[model samples]
Target: MILDKEILAGLIEGSPYPIYLILGEELRVALANAATLKAWGKDASVIGKRFLEALPEIDGQPFEALLRQVMRTGEAYYAVNDRADLMIDGQLKTFYYTFSYQPVKDADHQVIGVVCYATDVTQLVESASNISRMGLEAVENNERLAAINEALAASNEELATTNEELTESTRLLELSEGRFRSLIQQAPFAICVIRANDLVVTELNDRYLELVGKERTQLDGKPIWDGVPEAAEVYAPVMEKVFQSGEAFFAKEAELTLIRNGLAEQVFVDFVYEPVSDLSGNVSAVMVVGIDVSEKVRTRHAVEEVEERIRLAVEAAEIGTYDLNYKTGELVGSARFDEIFGLGNGVNRETIIDHYHPDDVHLSVLAHEEARKTGRIFYEARYIPKGLPLKWLRFQAKVYFDANGNRLRTLGTVMDITVYKALQQQKDDFISIASHELKTPLTTLKASLQLLVRMRENPNTVLFPKVIDQASRSMDKITELVDDLLNVSKINQGHVGLKKNWFNLSDMLEKCCIHVRESGSHELILEGDKSLMVYADEHRIDQVVVNLVNNAVKYAPDSREIFLGIKSLGEMVKVSVRDNGPGIPADKLPHLFDRYFRADERGTQVSGLGLGLFICADIVQRHGGEIGVESEPGQGSNFYFTLPLGEKEE
Candidate 1:
């Protein structure tokens, strides 16, 4: 396949089109004829130069790679109408060419060089492109016509089907009249037809006979004076009005005295007298549809007594109702509520909640969201109502859902609990004064009694020593109760200071649980993180733990095990006391931490004043933490409190 250098030079020189020969690894141009040099805007000075150097304008052209590929594989390459930017007459112009890269092989079948031949085809390529665009336009027009024809076919089919349905509707109308008669005979409510002109009974269904206490032999097709005289006088006028005005009459809570059980009993009803039309669209008869609502009326009236009692109590307490519209964020107040809140009738959620004490606003919002989830709300907070100074108000709401079953609104009452709060403050003050006054003398009495027992030879020698021992225990119980009261009073006065110091929460829990188990039949098991530490009032937190543990032992008598759990939760440390008792009821869970609220209906034989959890809640809340319980009827209970793991410097 090899060609001599001299022979290849003569062939290239004789070629009429642009052609060039390149050889070796460097791809230097072996020869370029007059046409090749002319097309490149160069002369014979480019001969024996690198193919790229001869025409540096085509530096990134595809021909270079194509030629190298053929020289390596010894296979010829052909490209048609390949684009190239060439410098012709010292000006760059775009050109298209059909070119070939042929391998020039030496002996032993090795490709030593590549010869390139090219022919310009810019005019032919442009003409074919124009024909392709015209073909595409014709295809698109055909497709549009095909779509229109398909739509026309669908329209024709719909018209034919519509005519068929019209004919079928006429036939079905005749059949529906017979079916309507059968349906009226089997209706559940009382249905009776009366003649509009004479106001006489025309037809009566079975339910109508049952309602009126008469049968077909006495009542059917009868005049007003012939059968039920009482019914005629009352229904005749209503029938006459419906027929004359062609309008239906609907009566809610209508009462009719009928003879039943040998006595005249008043029967309540919700009845509608609808005018029946003839073929000419004239009122021909009056059809009565009545539903018995006697039982519902009786039940409502009986419950009204209880509701009236509650209403009087609310009025006496100056409680008022309010509504929260979640969609518009508006707050609607009742007369008393408006007077207490002074927000008139048009306040918003943000504006009203903003009026709450800044520390308690977040808790109010949480209670609101909880109401939406559980459909119950009960919380107390301080509000700065306009025209009135800050007062304590108890917010209670019931959530209502929209048609789509989403929480739509919350309607509830707000009680002016300022007076109650003042009373509570006074009670706390009295307890604080009494506890402080009693503790001093009680301490002196305990010391004097102990010294007397020591002066005797032995405690068993004197009968009074046993009495003193029992009295000491009684005094100890009283002292503990007084301490709790004092703590609560401190909390109420905002003086329950936290002596915060870093201490192990688990160790504190163990000590509290051990103290509770010392006098009880319960066993305490400490679990979870043993090394969890928190910065809080050690004595105050101990009181919270002891309160929860004592409550578990009191309520859970059947179960002997109580679990004390401590865990680190992000920046907060959690301490929980779980019990295996007969858990709390759902209705009583909300009031568990309220002051003086005992869940046991049988009274407080086991608990002192029901202020244990209340005191605990106050202490935990003062430390900027939360206390809660998770319980169900039979699943036992878990009461937990969380304290933030305060900042530390290492």
Candidate 2:
């Protein structure tokens, strides 16, 4: 009796092993079950395609040749552990499978086509592929012998012979499945197996090894954290949970530092730690499956930072933000925006139009319309609320669109320009007032001087010459004071210019002492090393020394003696002026250098705008130097400053 093809197919299809049927001599795959199709990561579309065509990733591999050889020679071929690089998720990866190719013969005892039976052994062989390539060609001695002996048997006697052959095939398939492993090991998803006890890596697929920048030899059987120290802190606690509790742990968009090419890099991943159990139902290992989303995470973070910076800029500028939904005719605003418009957060079409001043309503509508049509907004309008102050609001916005280019909404900013307007007006008014006030007084003084010159021939002119001289000196002092005020303004505006040149610090001190000595009974003394050179604005330093020495004389009139000293430090020089009078109080000393701050007047003979020390402080600071004072209640005070040494050094 000949076994029907349908019956043979039914027997093999019920087996769990991957099985495919080939037709005619071409070995075109006739049928492939769900298990075989899934292993290939293929679908029903591959049913009619040739086995080689279906798995183009396996081109140049030995499977095609082995299958054809089994058909050509009528001998069975078995692969113990084989490497088949297959395309998985667009990336070609190496996979190992243990399988067999057996010949199927026609009723005439001539080989027609071959049957392919496979068991995925990738996980088992990948861990130890370097061991050797174990491929063996074997013939089914028992099956062939039984086929020959039973060939001559009566048709009724052949049933038992067929039963014995079927039983042997089933036993072989079971042994193969048990010895090999799952093809899922070659999946694109990264998988790393860590032993439960030491949490050491016992096995990892190619994808996992590549993701972590590690070699199998370096990581297999090693502590998981030893290779990637960054993952230790992040994975330890969660892995412990999975191992001890036997519960799986999952994290989406988790970030951790990993070593890539010898540099620490941040990698974001979606991953899971699953507990794998042994035959005894005890959890033995933890498997890690991860997908790297580092690029996506970095892109998202960059966008978030840009958005945050925009938010901060708006806040710092005190600009208000708003979103206008054109479809819904609604306007929503941030808190500051609502404050600017003097309205509640529920801004709609009514408030957008009516909240503005009546005079600006027409201009606001025109701007809104233009923004909707052109996707850009640039306009300024007034916002006047009942019983509240009016403000000039500058409106700026841009429109956005949906994916289909449908008009979506507008995002805009509003800023109150009232203070800017007020300052501009004040600037204009000050110029007019100063010109009128100064010109009239100067003109009157000039006319008075001319009249005096004209009267110099009269007897009264002789008496008035001193008066004219005094008036001229008074005018010069007034002009100087005015220039000082202007200089103070320029310094406050951070526009003061310095003419820098090299000068000797000790010589400048001596000249300042000489000037003080000329007009006062107080003795002026200079000490310290001479010829100390410094890089600075020489005129500014001269001004600083003059102010310090004069202040010492004015504040300590009782102290006839003053000491001006200069010393050289490394790359720097120090200058100090010490005075001995009823010394400054501790509280008053701190404010002495502050602009317009006057010390105790009991001993101070100085009278001016009180900007001398303030200007000195500014001059020293601009040259990258320090200026301060040291004083006590009864002891005299010392005002000192230090300057960097110039390049010209003796």
List TM-scores for all candidates, in order. Answer: 0.33, 0.46
Worst 10 residues of 2 by lDDT: 130-139
Q: List the residue pairs that clash in candidate 2.
A: none
lDDT of 1 by residue, 299-353 (tens): 3444334445555666787778766768767676667887777776666677778
Report residue 393 deviation for candidate 2 (angstroms).
Answer: 1.4
* Best candidate (score: lDDT): 1
Show model 2 residue runs off by greater than 4 Å: 1-185, 195-202, 221-241, 349-359, 369-374, 401-408, 441-481, 487-650
Residue 264's lDDT within candidate 2 is 77
Q: Write the per-residue lDDT of candidate 2 for residues 534-626, one digit (tens) a residue.
A: 888888888888788778877888899989888888888898989987788888877877765568433235445566788889999888889
